[model samples]
Target: MKGKLRPVGSPVPFPRISERQELPWAALYHTEFMGSGTEALSLAVAIAIRRHSQVSTPEVIIPAYGCPDLVSAIIAQGAKPVLVDLLPNGPHMNDVGVRGATTPSTVAVVGVGFLGIPERLEELSGICREHNLLLIEDSAQCFPPASASKPHADLVVLSFGRGKPINLMGGGALLVRTDLAGQAEEAVAQYPVSVLKVGMKWLIKRLLFNLLMRRLPYYVLERMPLLGIGETSFHRLDTISRLDLPESVLQAGLRDFQRRPLIHQRYDTELAGLEAWGWKCLASDRSEMSRNDPQQPVPLLRYPVLAPSKDMRDRALAVLNSEGIGASAFYGRTLPQIEGVEAAVGGRDYPVASDFASRLLTLPTHEGVTSADVTLIGRILFSVAES
Candidate 1:
C-alpha cells in the first residue's frame, strides 16, 4: 500500500482561458484581481461592512460546513461570523437557518457552491433583499465559474489557487455588482500593487508541481509530513494586494476550466449506480435555479457525495485513500470543530452541519483524473460499501 502509485490529492494542471470569458462579467460588474481568493473575499467583506457602517459590530452569515477561510475573511474585516447550519444532508445552508441567523448586525450572507455545485443563490438573493443584506457568491470551488450575465448575488469571489477549478498557482478575483461598484473600487484603490512575477522561475515551479503530481512521485510526496501535501489551515488575510494578470497563466487556467466538465462527467457516469448502495451524488440534487445552467455541466473542484452513514464514510475513505485514489473527507469537521474557529464564531451545536461533515466525501475531479482512474474509484467505493 505504501509504495503503490497514487495521484496527488490536488494538482496544479496547466490550461488556457480566453479573454472572451471576461466579456460578460466586465459588462455586468466591476472586476478586480487580487493575490488570492481569500484576499478577494476579504475585500468583499470589507465592502459589505462599509455598506452597513451604521451597524456596530457587524455580522456575516456563513454555512457551518465550509473552509476556515470563510471565518478568516469575516474576521479580517473586524466583523463577526454567524454560523448557520447546512441543509439536512446537503452542502448549502438551510434557507430557514440563514433567515433565523440574521439580525440587526447581519450585513451579508456568503452563499458557497460547495464542490462545484452552485448554491441556491436566487433564493438567497431574495432573502438578502428582504433583510436588506448583501449576498456574496463564493465561487471558489465551481466553474464555468460564476458570471454576472445572470447576476444572482451582489458580489462574486473566485479563486485560482491549487485544486480550484482554474488553478493559476495563486490569484483570485472579485466581481462587484453595479450598485456596490463604488465601495469595491474605493477599497481596491488603497491596496498596494503586488510585485509577484510569473517568469521562468514560476514556470519551473509549476512544471515541477505537475511533475510531482504524477502517481509515482505523489505516492512518495504524500508520506512526507513536512510538505503538508493536502492540509487545510486558517491563514489570516493581512492585506489585500492588487495583482497584474499574467496572460499566459490566465489563458491556461481558462482552458483548464473548460476541460473540467469532461472529467466531472466521467465521475458522474462511472458512479451512476452507487446510489443503490447508499451513496448520494450531490450533482443529481442541484437546484434548477442555481447558477450552473442545466444545459452546461460546470466543473466542480471535486465531486462530493454522502455515504450512507458515518461508519461507512470512514471505511470508504480509509479504503479509497489507501488505494491512492485521492478520495477525501473534506474538512472532516464543521466550522466550530476546527482548531481556532469556535473562538471566532463562538461554540454552538450545529447538529445538521456535524452530520453532513461526518458523512461527506469528495473525490478528485481535476484534469489529471483519467477514465480508468474513475472506474477504479467507483469499483473501490462500491466494494467498500458492500463490505
Candidate 2:
C-alpha cells in the first residue's frame, strides 16, 4: 500500500538575492565555472595530460564504484580510464587497488569523496607524487569547511547539480592548484559556451525537477520510467559538452555554499537520531576531520546506509516509497556493472565494488526534511530492518 511520501533529497530553496555571500575557497584557488561536474572533470583531464611526453596511451585511474560520468569525462578527453576497487566499507578507493591499477600510461588519479565524506586524499596524494601522477579530488558531494586545510590533490572539482552539496540546479567549478592554473586555463579556452538550445534545455530541466521533486508529484512520476525521473544510464562521451551557467544559478550556488554550516547541523541531528534508533550509516565518523576532533560535524549530501542484503534493501525501499519517505538504492550497480558501459570501457574484476553497490541505500538530509520527519524515518528503518 502507498504511504506518505518523504523524498530522500530536496531541492535547494530558491535563493534570496539579499543573502548572496562570498565563499572563502573561491579566494584560495583558481576557479572556473562550468555547466556540470562532468565538464569540470573532462577539462581537468585535458589539462593534466596536455603536455605529457608519454608515448603510451594516456589513462586516468578512477574509483570502480563511481558515476559513469567520471569514465565518460576521461574518454571524452581521448584518454582511457583504469578502474580501481573500493575499500570494503566503500565509497573510498582501496589504496592497494589504486597502487596495483597504476600503469606507466597513468597520467592522473581521481580521488572521489563519495556522499560528502572526503577520501584519504593525503595518502592518495603521496602515492600520486611517488608515481609522478596528478591527483584530482572529486568533491562533487563535499563542501570543505572554511576553517579546514586545503585538500592535498592537485585539482578539485565541485558540482552544483540538482542534489549536490551546493545545488543551484546546474553548474560546476574546477579549483586548480596554482601550479596548473596556466595549463587548465588553456584547456578550458578550447570549449565554447553551450548554444542557446542547450541552455534552454537546462532551464527547462531545472524547472521540471523543482516541480516534480516534491512528495506527491515525485511518488507518481517516479514510477513512470518514460519520464526518467531518477533513472541512471550510461551516456556517450561525445554528448558531453560545456554549457554556460545561468547567472541566477551562480548566485544561488554562492549563497548555498555559505549556508553549509546550518545544513550540516540539520544533518548531524538527523544522523544522530537515526543512530540512536540502531540504524548503521555507510559513512564512518572516523574520517580525517572526525579523528582530529570527534565533536566536529561532517556535512553530508545524503545519509547512506547499507542494508543486510540486496533483498532487504529492496524491501526497505518499497516500504519507504509506500510511506512517502524518500529513500533510494543509489547507483544500483558499480561502474563496470552499469549497463552499456562495460562494452565501452572494457571489463575489470571488482567483487567488492559490486557487493557494496547492491547494499547501499540513502536517506534525505536536505533542509526540507524536519526533525519529526527524521523520527518517522528512523522508526520506518527500524521496522524494516527487523522485518
Candidate 3:
C-alpha cells in the first residue's frame, strides 16, 4: 500500500513551539486548552448551564448524524442529549428538526461542522438566542483562515485529534464568548494539567499512525480492537476526564495550522476535478456557506460522496481498497444507533441521519494524495456507480 492515497487527514509533525503566545485564533476569544475535543465540549456544556432544582434533567440538542463523543460529552456533564436529524442528502442539521426538539429542559444546542463543512451557524445561532439556549460550535473538522473573524456561536470548540484539520494527535481548545469568559475560566481552573507521560504516548502514537495508516499494515492492525486504529465504539461518561494540552502538542498544532492556505488550495483544485466528473459530494462546498469568502479557500479533511445505497458504498470501498486507493465508509451507523447511546436519545428514529450514514463514502484529500490520484479515484467510483 506504499502508493495508496490515504483516506481522511494528513500526518501530524512533532512539536517545536517557536512562539506559543502567537498561535492562530489565540486573541479572538478567551481560550482554554484541553487534552481532547470531548473534554473541551464537556467543559463548555458544564459552564453554559445553570443548575436548577426545577429542571432535574437538563438537555442539549445535537445532530443525529454526529460523532459519538458529542453524546458522551453531554452525558458526562449530567445532561441528556436531544438528537435532531440532518437535512435530506446534506450534512447540516435540519432547522425545523432542531426547533421542534427544543423544549423547556433544553439549555443548549451544539452545531457540528462535519468533515470541514460549516453548518448553518448564523441561522442556528438565531434560533438558540430566541429560545434562550446557549449555542456551541463544534468546529473540530472545519478550520477557517487564521486571520478570519470568529464564528457566531457562544462557545467554539476545536480538535487537534488524529484525523481532524490540525492533526496534533491529541489536543483541543475551547473559546468562550466575552460574556461567558469569566465563568468559563473559573470552571476550568479546577482541572489538572496533562502529565508528561501522556504527551509522550501521544507523540509515539502519532508517528505510528502516520507510518501505517492507509497501508496494508493498517488494514490488518485495524481489525484488532485493542490497537484502536479506526475502531468506533462508545466511551463511558466517566472516561471524559479533563487534562491540560501539552506544550509540545500545542506547538505542533500551531505549525500545522500555519500551513492551512496551501492545503486548502490543493483541496479546491482536486475537488473541482472530481466535481467536473459529475460526482455529488455529501456536504455542501465551503463556498456555498455565507461566511466563507470565495477568494479564500478552506481545506476539507476528506472529499465525501454519496453512493446510491449501502451495498454500492461497500462495493466501492472494496474495489478502491484492492487498488491501493484509500476510500472509506464514514460513520457506519447514526448517533442514536451506537451501542449504549440509545437510552440517552430515547430511541428516536432519524430517517435522514440513517439514510445519510448508509450512503456516505469519503476519499483522501491529504497532501499525500495527488491530482492524478483523484482521476483514478473518479474512474473507480464511476465504475462502481454504473455497476
Candidate 4:
C-alpha cells in the first residue's frame, strides 16, 4: 500500500462502497436534533423531571456500556450521574446492581439500545415507570428495526453520525414519547440552527468520500500547486464536517443504502477464519427497516459480541492495526465507572455494561477491508492466538 499524507484531524473516505445493503433507521432522523445527540438527550431528560425537587442535585441512572457523551451531557445540564453496569453485549441491565445503588434522588434510568442485541427497552421502561422514575433510551446504539420495542421511555435520543445505523454526516434526534415531548421541543427549538455549518458538513462528506474512493482529482490527493491544502488546513464550520444536520435533509437523503457496497461480502470472506470472532447476527434474515428483504443490502455497521478475554482482545487489535485494518476497543471504559457517577448512582454495579466495555472491539469490516484483507487480518490474529 502506498503512503498518503493526511493531516492529523482530516478524515479519509471509505476505500470502497458496495451498493446492496439495508439502511438502518436512525440515519433518517439525524438532522432534526437541536444540538449534538448528547445535547438533545440532555434536554429531553431534563424536561422529564419535575420543577420541585428537595435534593440539592438531580440524578439519572446510566448503564456503564455507553459513550462518554452521557456523562458530558449530565455535567452540562447540572445534573448528577448514576452509573450502573449492563449485561454483556445484550441490552440487559443489571437491575439488581442498579437498585442496590439507587437512591431516593434517582430520577431516571437511561437505556441505550444495542446493535443485533434486543434492547431491554420494555423491561427497563416497566421498571422505571413502576418506580416512578423516568427512562431515556439512547437509540444511538440500537438503530431502528433493531429497536427491541416501542419503549415506553420518557425520552429517546437518536444519532445519525459516522457508521451509525443511519449514515448522515452529522446529526441526532431528540424524541420525547411521554408527556414531556412538547416541553423538550420548546427548549430545543429555542436553540437557533446553523445553515453555514450544515452546508460545510455536506461538502466535507462529499469531498472526503470522493477522494478516498479515488474519485477526486489527483491534484487534491497530492496537495500540489492547485490543491496543496492538507487535511489539517481547516477546522471551521465553513471548511469541514461540523456534523450539523437539519431534519428535512435527513428525511430526504440520509442513510441511502442504495449507495455502493450494499453487501460488504468481501469483508466477511476475509474475517471468517477467527477462532471466535463473536459476530452479532440478526435474529432473522428479514430486513428490520424495509419490512422485507431488499435485493441488495449493507449489513450492520458493527458486529458486536463478547470475546474470551482482554488479552485476546488486545492481541487481536494489535494484529489488525498492524495490518492497516482499523480496529476498536469500543467504549473501553464504561461511563458508570467514574467516581462522580458512582456517587450519583447511590452505589449500583453495572456488571453487564462493564463486561461489554472490557471485551467489545469493532473491526474494520465495512471500509473496503476486503475478503483478502480479512484473510490477512485473520492469519495475523490466528498466529497471535496460537503463540
**Candidate number of the best lDDT:** 1
Worst 10 residues of 4 by lDDT: 232-241
Each model's lDDT comes to 0.79, 0.72, 0.73, 0.53
For all candidates, what are the clash counts?
A: 8, 10, 0, 31
Residue pairs in candidate 2 whose N, alpha carbon or C atoms collide under 3 angstroms: 3-322, 4-323, 4-324, 5-324, 6-324, 6-325, 6-326, 7-326, 8-326, 8-364
Q: Which 10-residue window of candidate 3 scores lowest in summed lDDT?
A: 283-292
Give the per-residue lDDT of model 4 (tens digit) for 287-330. 44322343434345554434567777787776665555555665
lDDT of 1 by residue, 1-387 (tens): 334334222556554444545434666777788899988888888888888889999999999889999999889889999999887778878999898989999999999978777888888998999999989999888654454547888889989887676777788988888777876677678787786577678879989977777777787888899988777676776777878886666766665555544566787788888999988998777642222345655656677889999999999888887777888888989888888888898788899999988998888876667777788889988888888
List, residue by residue over 226-275, the lDDT tens digit for candidate 3: 87655567886564445556676666665665564344344345445444
Q: Which ten residues in a row have the lowest lDDT in candidate 2?
A: 286-295
Off by over 4 Å in 4: 1-32, 51-56, 88-91, 115-118, 145-149, 178-180, 183-186, 196-205, 209-248, 252-255, 258-298, 336-355
Question: What lDDT would candidate 4 get against the real structure?
Answer: 0.53
TM-score, prediction 4: 0.69
Estimate the overall C-alpha local distance difference test score of candidate 1.
0.79
Model 1: lDDT of residue 200? 76
Q: Tell me each candidate's TM-score.
A: 0.92, 0.86, 0.87, 0.69
**Candidate 1, run of 10 with poorest lDDT:** 1-10
Candidate 4 at 185: error in angstroms? 4.6
